[model samples]
Target: MSRKTFIKGTLILTLAGVLTKIFGFGCRIFLSRSIGAAGMGLYQLIMPVTAVCYAIGIAGPEVCVSRFCAAYAASRDHLRARHTAVFCFGMSMILCIICTVLSYMGADIIAGYIFHNPHVAPLIRISVFSVPFACIHCLVCAYYISKERTVIPAVSQIFEQAVRLGAIYIIVHIAHNKGEEITAAVGVAGLVCGEIAAALLCAAIVLTGRRKNIRTTRHPGIEVKQIIKTSIPVSLNRLALHGMQSLEAALIPLMLTVYGYSAQHSVAIFGILTGMAMPVILFPSTLTGSVAQMLLPSVAKEQSSSDKLIKSSRMALVFSLAFGFICIIGYTTAGAVIMAYVFDEPKLSGYIRIMAWLCPFIFINTTYKSMLHALGQAGRVLLNSMLSELITIICIVFLIPRMGIYAYLLGLLASQAANSALSICAFTRTVSRITTHKPLRS
Candidate 1:
């Protein structure tokens, strides 16, 4: 794609992201208010598991499809692009189905042994239902994104958020009308419904819009091998990262209890940090994410240039740094006010303020990882991520008892800074050596 087309696609994604974020914030505010911190904690507790499952089932394949399809589509080999999608989609469907069955069957072990809460069992079962839907939706969205038709994906995102909110409103209040308090299962039901709607929407677009002239037969064996080859490394990289994150989620609340706090209080505190403050801090990251989305496929093209890669990297860097510092100033200036005004959690200003230092590095880290992944440096991405998460996990294990939540706050800053620095250094070296020769896209 030309630079103009890339910018157009990024802008479309950014606009859609902004709207989705707004609707998401609305859902958060209302959900928190209706269900209270305990309920929010319940939902937050399940997020790490959700992330892990989604990473294994969808994130890797979706990214592989996006990057490889764009590579194929750029050469005008539309048949190969279709084949990539089919192979990845089939892979995702099988994995997600297996995940769903295991999650449902082992919910008791996960809730009892892993999370130390029995109520979480039902919520896990409910949330697992969304995995298949989300996996299929991701593959479909990847195909459209590879074609640079951002409008369809954008519409699907908005539609999903709207459906989630509407479903939450109805599901939560129906239980209320029956004199029952809102449950985490109900919250997850909303997510499942939304995913199903989104899956259907994207499937309609991809299946109905195919041109008749495109080839009808593709070598499933060859394409499947190619897709898995690209996807497995990315999958393992993300799986390791998310697996550590899930471990961190379980550890955070447990370790906080050593600070002489009740488990309920610790869970509530975790909810505030993960569910409330972190989202606010990461709000502007939507732009970086949009650029990353566009960057992957653009960089995956065989004809992609060294100059173009460097230009995009530098642009993402400047924007991330400028925006990061700008956000730091905003959070430092009125974090308390914003928290109070937005999520009604005024006390979390300290967490937000402390985490402000992570903005630039975190944002820049996202762009670098995307560029590196498309550049076929999955091992480097995995190493940087593992190192970062390792640092955070180590700190949580050793220091949360002595320093309490402040330990986590400092650990996050240190980890993001470490990850970002490593990625930038790797990218810089890769760029310098490849200045006179094209880096391998695959």
Candidate 2:
């Protein structure tokens, strides 16, 4: 691959990132308005459960597919790369099916006990349909990303968002027209619709695209060892991390009630912070996230070239940190106006103001985590992420009642900052070993 390929890949992903975020932002605004903050709260509660299912279903293969395929592709082994994609798709499908079944069956327990809201069982069950389809989408996107063929994933992202928005609008309208309330359950249905549409399109692309693109090469590929080596560590890491995050998501609302707030009030507060303020806080990451994601394959491909690795690392860090600081400034300066204008939830402005400072930490940690995965140190990446998430959970567990949701915000920044520090240190050590111990070679 050439520099132009890398640049083109980054541009395609970045453009897609920007467009997706914009469309997603619009969706959040519309959803928040249609369902109200309390409904958003219920909706937010369901997402962590969905994420947990997704982590079980597809998270391992998603990263493994990208890293291993990139390595194989860089070696000019298209057959191994394609086989890896196929294998990952299979693994993801099986896991997602298992997760869907489990989630659907356990929806009552998850809603009543885990989420602390028995009323949320319907939404949880409804959200289960998204799991398998979402898993398929994840595997498909990772394959295209590894091959530097971003156009497929980019277009599919647009398709997903469009379908999601249209479905949501229609669902909300029909419910209102029928003189029924726009419950959060209806919101979950829209989520399922979008996932189904995206998955169908992605499977079509992956199948048809492969027939046109694949050519039998000498390399038959390792059936599953390499993928398993990477996936087990990554899977465990993500499962633990996201599982904790789900706890945090659920705990925050539950703890709010302990802080003397009503359950509805607490859920609304959680919804505002997550659904409204967070979208704005993370908007600028569209650029950095694309760069970080593309960096995985690029960095993996150039592992022996210290100069290239160092240069890529520096540029990603500098750009992400600078842009992240800009996000901080933007959110601090105009967060209130933006929230009021866009979401009409000016209450979220304070949360945004508090959380905006997390941008640099979040951005830098994201970039470095990708670097770790590219360096084949996914275990280290997972360790740091789990630590970060654990700290947030600690805060949510012990402090939310005393300090309110601000504690979670503080925990978010603190955890990200710590993760960034630790990951960068690990990355620095890895690069130093690669550069000093051996001569540069392709």
Question: lDDT by residue for model 1 over 318-383, one digit each (tens)?
Answer: 989999999899988886477756777766778888888889998999899998888877778888
Against the true structure, candidate 2 reaches a TM-score of 0.95
Task: Give candidate 1 regions above 4 Å deviation.
Answer: 211-224, 302-304, 436-442
lDDT of each: 0.84, 0.84
Clashes of 1: 0
**Model 1: per-residue Cα lDDT at residue 1:** 77
Model 2 C-alpha lDDT per residue in residues 1-442, reported as the tens digit of each score: 5789878888898888888888788788888988899988888888888888887778789988888888888789878787778888888889888888988899899887888789888888899899988988888899889989999888988888888888988988888889998788777887889889999999898778668874654657475976787887778878888798888888998888988899999999998988888788888887778878888888888888878878887887888789888888888887667776778886877888888898988788888888888887878887898888989989898998998888888888889889989988888878888978843211
Error of 1 at 376 (Å): 0.6
Q: What C-alpha lDDT, on a 0 to 100 scale, does residue 254 get in candidate 1? A: 92
Query: Which regions of candidate 2 are displaced past 4 Å?
Result: 213-219, 436-442
Report the C-alpha displacement of residue 426, candidate 2, in angstroms: 1.1
